[model samples]
Target: MTELVATTPGLLPLPDWAKGELSDLKGHQKSDLIDGTEGEAVTEAYDRVRAEELDWQTEAGLDRVVGGQARWDDNIAHPLSMADAVDTRGIVRYYDNNNFYREPVVVGELTATGDVAAELDATAEALDDGAGDLQAVLPGPYSLADLATDEQYGDEAAFLDAVADFLVDEVEQFPDVATLFLLEPSLVENPPEAGIDERAGAAIDRVATATEADVVCHTYWGAVPEKPYAHLMDADLDAVGFDFVSDHEANLYNITEYGTTDDIALGLVDGQNTRVEGVETVRERVEWVGEQIPAQSFDTTYLTANTELFYLPVNRAREKLAVLARAAAGEEEVTA
Candidate 1:
């Protein structure tokens, strides 16, 4: 029997209370010199938000929940930006969205900063004693290279290779978790140059294989082009996520023609939109995909938003999680 699981691409909108807490903390820091207490306060606020976000997912009946990446102000690039090799430069719009991140410019040879492993340990500590199966999120090699300003690595392939190797080092240190969502928006937003798709796939495979947890190479904004989709299928990923909410016709065609992994993530809900989807609506979308791909079968079908939920308000993001859980479990509405 195929298992239907509910999850997300990981980042979620910060709640109003958390925003207030951060604001107060920042104000305190501005008034005082750079002190350990100020940093601790910021971390304390993030911890609170992370725990609350996990609780939200748990309450919604999600099978595998993320820490919600509440501390990630720079979105997918945050983990790598923490490294000494990267420098924060001018702001760049994240995809076509209004969201922006301080562009991470590669200034030196890349290195694993150990931030991801520390974050994982912290997430484990934030857990409410055996309540939720933790999940981690990271920017995939392709997107990281594509999005960043490559000042260090002179060659394109070398830059991509370095980023992949850096990620592999980071992944190798990961404490076992339920899932690892490797966000690769560039595969859909801006695909690699011709004949380079296989190299990209190999890079992704290296990172995916380094971890024991199930890795989902999630692409969003639109469907991955046919050639890249074919190459992605060659990777060692457990599941390949597609944005069914945007340009899903292309996504459906790719799946039917090229086929995907035995386990797949159907991004059936709109992550950026405030309009929350209902159980039946999402279920119908899943059913439709199944109907279209009758020749192919999935061992596990993950119900998720097409992109990160940070674009929506916290309440709406929470509602989206509930809808995904409800749809997967065949529940018409949320239950007390």
Candidate 2:
């Protein structure tokens, strides 16, 4: 198994040329825009931004590259929009802060137009073409079901299974891409009122079983449920990502134990906050973890606790985060 890894948390600002009318929408005041009026124009912009972000990650010395999620509205909304399986009642918060509401779009039956595969391929091609490593991000099945309206699914378990199958189908489309398939199960941190652990586990299992890509299940926003980690262990995934900013001690304990099985995508940088971490502090943290696990037992990645693109201006965020990554890698000296 390959060793020593670092990552920037997923999602980056869409370039001006890709955003289109997505910016005109009431809540998307901070989106990037594509230059042309046509749909193809919008897609081309997405492709360009994806390629650029992958390049940035590679230049920053990141081992695994994320598509930067330039093609989606928000992180969770991307898969929901693709599945067409939710009804946004125009009152839904675009993010947790209630800054903007989704304009109440109805999710129709699930369909795969192969657009996702094309998007993934375009990103993979960009990375390969540039000789950069790349990874793809997907909204997890439970997260999708949690975001969808209860009225639409009737039974969340069944709905999650269907979405998982859809995700599996999409993932299989990119077999040769030497990238980890990252599943963002943001909703798992705060499950729906009607959700059960078993059902969510089953949904995740479906995706795990169907796709051959190395999987990295990520649960951001808060602490991950123990059951999900156990479920992931049972499945065929290659690693699990956890947010350490909020509960570092607990997460560190979890990683010390189960982290042996999979590479640990340790989110040391706080995505929600703009306060940059110092090099010495970050190095000490990484060294502490290294002492617990052999260099081979677990690998670490530097990432923001959440999507830095959502909170900070892109360039500033990238600059600050690059420092944090350098700190974690022991590449730079700590200053007073």
Candidate 3:
């Protein structure tokens, strides 16, 4: 029996009211700082925002909704930057996106930053009291190394090894998490300098082996480059997510040439674009993907947006999730 699950890569926009609420909460945090309080306001705001996003995901009928990444301060690396060994720098442009994050500078020996797990647990606890399965998103080691400045570790492989080990340790802490998505956009955007793809695969293997949840290595924005694509299939992951919305052909070809038959997370919806895709259009694309792959390659399929839906307005993002849910459930297709 094939199980169809609909979920996102885990960043959803806040509703209009919550957006206003978040601004007010930020102001409150500033006032608390001036008053010399402990700054619980920010934590409170994150919890509230997370619950709201969970409600939206449930309302949209997402079978396996993520925590929605409400704790992401700027880019996906925000929580990682707050680790004990990391020195946070000023705002830096993330990729070519308008989003900005304080650069995570590795100042000492790499270790688990308790912030990521704590936030995940909080969000998971919140979702436990709600309607959807709990999920956590972790930044991939390759992407983390790419986004950071390694002030301590001189050798690139050594640094990447440290990053992967730390992530493996982090994932081990989430025993109850239903799913874990490792965002590895860097592999597609900037392939490793050289001789690093093997390390990348090892790192993924460490985490995937250590975790109890369904682990997925989700690469987006483009096709996985030939370098990393060469060895990524051997990693112990439950599913490899491909961003069909961006470059479906190359992704499918990579699967046929370099990958084995495995469960797959099909990324058919466009998260960065404003235009909402119709239910029928997305289903057609999913079918097209099936024709491109070996007939028995997938037993379980995750219907998802290509990346975070934070780029869209809250209402539009919710609509997209709803359409994905509709398609995955084999309901009548609505007019992309």
TM-score each candidate.
Answer: 0.95, 0.79, 0.92
On lDDT, the leading prediction is: 1
Model 1 has how many clashing residue pairs?
Answer: 0
Looking at candidate 1, the ten consecutive residues that score lowest on lDDT are 30-39
Model 1 sits at a Cα RMSD from the real structure of 2.2
Best by TM-score: 1
The lDDT of model 1 is 0.86
> Which residue pairs collide, candidate 2?
16-33, 17-33, 17-34, 18-33, 18-34, 19-34, 86-107, 88-104, 90-104, 271-305
Tell me the spans in candidate 1 whose CA falls farther than 4 Å from its real position: 27-38
Q: Tell me the tens digit of each residue's lDDT in model 2 across 217-275.
A: 67666656565555555655566666666676666666666553545666666666767
| Cα lDDT, all candidates | 0.86, 0.58, 0.80
Off by over 4 Å in 2: 15-38, 84-91, 98-108, 128-131, 150-153, 185-188, 192-195, 256-260, 292-296, 299-308, 324-330, 333-336
Clashes by residue pair, model 3: 277-336, 278-336
lDDT, candidate 3, at 149: 84
